[model samples]
Target chain A: METIVLGIGETLVRDDRHWASWANWLGVPAHTLSALVGAAVAQGRDATDALRVLRPGMDVDEAYLARAAAGRGEHLDESDLYPDVRPALAELRAAGIRVVVAGNGTVRAGERLRALDLPADLVVTSDEWGVRKPDPAFFARVVEVSGAKPGATLYVGDHPADDLFPAAAAGLRTAHLRRGPYGHWWAEHPDVVGTADFRVNALPELVGVVGGSPARPGAEPHSARPAFEDGTGAVGGARPARVSYLRGL
Target chain B: METIVLGIGETLVRDDRHWASWANWLGVPAHTLSALVGAAVAQGRDATDALRVLRPGMDVDEAYLARAAAGRGEHLDESDLYPDVRPALAELRAAGIRVVVAGNGTVRAGERLRALDLPADLVVTSDEWGVRKPDPAFFARVVEVSGAKPGATLYVGDHPADDLFPAAAAGLRTAHLRRGPYGHWWAEHPDVVGTADFRVNALPELVGVVGGSPARPGAEPHSARPAFEDGTGAVGGARPARVSYLRGL
Candidate 1:
């Protein structure tokens, strides 16, 4: 793979604190907020849309400002990252693959992600780009920023609707991380289960998806042996498949 | 190209009458509405967003209802079809390319398009899908319905921000149809100017972009000779290029 664009929440970092913080601010029980978030996700809507359901006509931006004033705004740190993030990112970068961490987070969240100094060429959030996921513009921005052609690039995320489907639609290869609630739930989605280019449980598996990296097996590089080359991609008869693991995984 | 997903407005059909109808209903000169629509498009906002600018907080749905109540609801017929649309679509279909016509039109527009019984395999509108273009989901729907992989499908549209860029992001090959104001205006956009896979002045050019059809040159069909192959697509080194007719036309 020429590049791997990772989704921030749930892919690179656990969103427990993030959602809990919103719950705390909204004066709702954490479980209540979490349940609502899950419900929203199950319906293929934005996670924060749960907030709209909980409070009609809620101004999320205003609420964010209110939370900031109350000393509880978007924040991130090394501890928030999944265990596989550091090693996988480092290995991918070592393999010469550009790594970008982008997803539906806030401007402050973007700042926090940058501050964490993740092993990524770029770290950004939806708010920073003034757009959100599932919108073609968000993925367009990701591809634009990565400087990789849509097919040469890969988008790794947990959410099926927000991440995998959109990224796939935007012409980027997709790796569905089978972690997080959305991941597990959407993994069974007909489209994701049947067509995802790479189905990985952890970030480290991506190194394999892109092909054995120099930092690992040192096999022929992915760029040299493109996946989906002859329209016999992972899902044969679909489009181009990468590297041809072609397994359900 | 396994499939060609043609955009509705300004691609297969002109939007003059549609916009004029809205202007008439809104009690504004057609020129005024047209100018405002262009302004919205130039700003990279939805064309209907111009209505919001014309009358603050105007409920477009409500306005449509009002107009419909006055027997001036959404309407379309054979007259709206651009002359190139019929022959281009018919030739593409005869050549075995799945043709899908989809774009940001209303439910009534979808019915009207279906009523036209265009040569396209499917005719759909954004309202029918409950999602609008510039949204990856829309393109994803186009791919899903066409049963073609994103890379194998070509999304032809006139607007850069709405049609070309977003479709490119979603992994479908993009052809910027140089027609109407949005087409010409967005064509000069740095991304569009430098990167659109196929820049065609007419739908007939798309047939060539896909490669010589049997009805024409009788050369190898487009699906038989994929563009963007070997990372030298229309915009070389971007993704898969179809037929290597990379040009700035």
Candidate 2:
């Protein structure tokens, strides 16, 4: 249970800039796009649905090309990541935890994340794999790249639909991080809170998730237990962890 | 537990060409160099000692440079690999085993192995890490890169002294491969055969080591058992597998 696999968007990088950039290209008020994005998440729809909702019958691919031609073509800089990301990742790797980054990102996004040189062993994306999360095959790929049994691997992400439930169903241990808009809204979802092994807020909290390590900067040691608490087998019954972010946002 | 970390020299590639080239550079009979290598292995000495014995006070680095100057610095092509290697590795990867290549090889050798594009998830050399085999730190690095607990990782190699015994001592599951001069002579070593989790003759036999998989092209299922037979914990006591390589060579 020394491996920790994390989702990319909300778990590692803040998606605020990515969405704001899209809002700028769409010639819509940023708040309008944010509201639509939040509504999409609340209704368990893909975030891209917001874009489709704004411009009905719009070709998403063509819009992507148009946006690129007009200049902002999916850039990822260090500023896009959560403030706690670097230290937590460094601590996890220093403690010999195999930190893997896997989630729904484009190939270019994967390249940018690698360019940042965050202390992860492997970083991959859905676009690179030709599959998206919540797909059982995607979870299988996670287990494959992890090179560890599902029970010995922990999949952490901010999305319940895309990250937690499916990963749990796929036999991997789950952690629900209450970051990003989706995480904030879905933090109270009965299924996610009920199925998660660790319900954490900040990224640095992962240092405490693994054994024999001090909490990294900004880590508040709460809720998460030993990584192997469930033993070396897939999730059988529900092992819940409460979302402690109630009072914050 | 789904990860298999292997030594490169005799487990995957045949060392005949490498040693022959070195003999060519040293201007010695191939058999003489081969016999010296066998003798060095038999006496529990490092294989490099043989080159030292062949030509007293010979600067190995200079010999390497001169060999390179002679247009045969280091060459690793398809023919260097054993015929069973590709099929066995392919089956392991297809079955979702995390195959890692970690061994006492030069950086150039590591690059050559990568160029071959074998089905390994990671290929690294001691030169890359600035540490060599039989060192506990090197074995620790194997578990680190594997991102699995030491109890769940398996270290396989042909050399008993550098590969089997040391890996076993460093809390990893061990397999003794009876392949080259080292493997053939050390197959009978009381300590190695007495400590290995699997003792095998050919690479393809590994398809049977993991769970729920058909044997590869040339595999003959013989002595290995389920990966988690001893359960998830470091090697506390010896769990031996006999060297069934009594017939072939």
Candidate 3:
């Protein structure tokens, strides 16, 4: 029973829309200096490097800010990582399941992952690997790092383009997270594989995939024993706090 | 040179988001049974017959009240259609271009058009025909009624699954209108031709596809002019619209 679980995407400091929300919160244009500069700095690209290629007049901070203001990047934090859910990585690992997080930028992914401090056996950065997911090459990298065959791996993600279609094309089983910003059409699809797809309303349900029977703060895992007596379990399923730690997206 | 236009869709009598802006002027929700009933009905399903099939037991009036309280499904009268950018459909027709508006229910489509009464040559109802756009058969019905070939006919609509994809598959040249309640994913597609295919931002832009120039309010027909306003015209100097309107799906 060699099992592997992986997640892949651009792990920017914050996405464009969130930057707009934060800008609204700070009463400053969130699309400005903070987003682009942070992305560029995290990705090891300097303000000069970005300027040399695209819009030369704009520097690093300015590019980040403008794009952010325009609502154009992908940003996921822990709370949003999977709201009302728990990352299933730990439970799978405890059951001897290997888990990996593949992303577009190493520095940026490292920054965000470190910020969330999610416990994972491996993290693959596209910047280092030179390819992003959806390209079979990216999936190949995951197979190499996690040492799991594509047939046995499950790629969990939100974007239809970057996640489901691509992973399915690469011979990997997919679990599309329909609970987030998947828009109305994708949400309206009936083939959503309700039970077969491991359809979860939140992240904490990830425990259900790896045969964990634990009780969380509120709901009971579908078929497992209550992992906690009270509200000490992760929002997905109950388990001792020591066996579980929360990670932001 | 004989041009015939057939329109499809539901002429629904439902409230839109803009209706709330005019609630005070329309005498609020306190009086006017027609306005009240009109406000109560939020979609084509709420129309006299369709609503009966969609939500059998749901009372239109009571549903209206509930939604009004929830700050949704507000009523929109004739005056609320705005952004001042809805293309002038009449001028497009007067310039020798045929227009067709197709949908699942013509009641809503008809209402939107009749509200504007922008003057297309023909109005085709889906209910009367028992066929809706996006089905090759529906466009065939449009051709049978209008005597136009599918290739020569141009279908302009908002729903991709319902309008663009089928029309493309049917051989009807498609023009996707980036308006209405349909989601923007279909509209903002980078490769618009791949998915429902052939895209545009507004309705009147279709004129440029045929031999005519972009029709503005009171613009002269293409026959009277030497060429388009500028160098921008259909490819190879062929009337894309005419060729479009003459081909079969």
Top lDDT prediction, candidate number = 2
TM-score of each: 0.44, 0.45, 0.40
Candidate that beats the other on DockQ, 2 or 3, i.e. the better one: 3
lDDT (Cα, tens digit) per residue for candidate 2, span A99-196: 99999988989999999998999999999999999789999999999877888788999777788878988888777887665555456555654577
Residue B41 in model 2: lDDT: 46
| Per-residue C-alpha lDDT of model 2 across residues B60-131, encoded as one tens digit per residue | 888898888889798988988878889998988887789999998889999999999999999999999999
DockQ of each: 0.01, 0.00, 0.02
Worst lDDT 10-window in candidate 1 chain A: A240-249
Chain B TM-score in candidate 3, rounded to 2 decimals?
0.52
- Flag regions of model 1 displaced more than 4 Å: A1-249, B212-249
State which candidate, 1 or 3, has the greater TM-score. Answer: 1
Count of clashes in candidate 1: 22
Q: Rank order by lDDT, top first?
A: 2, 1, 3
| Superposed model 2: Cα runs more than 4 Å off | A212-249, B1-249
DockQ of 2: 0.00
For candidate 3, what is the total of clashing residue pairs? Answer: 51
| Two-way lDDT contest, 1 vs 3, winner | 1
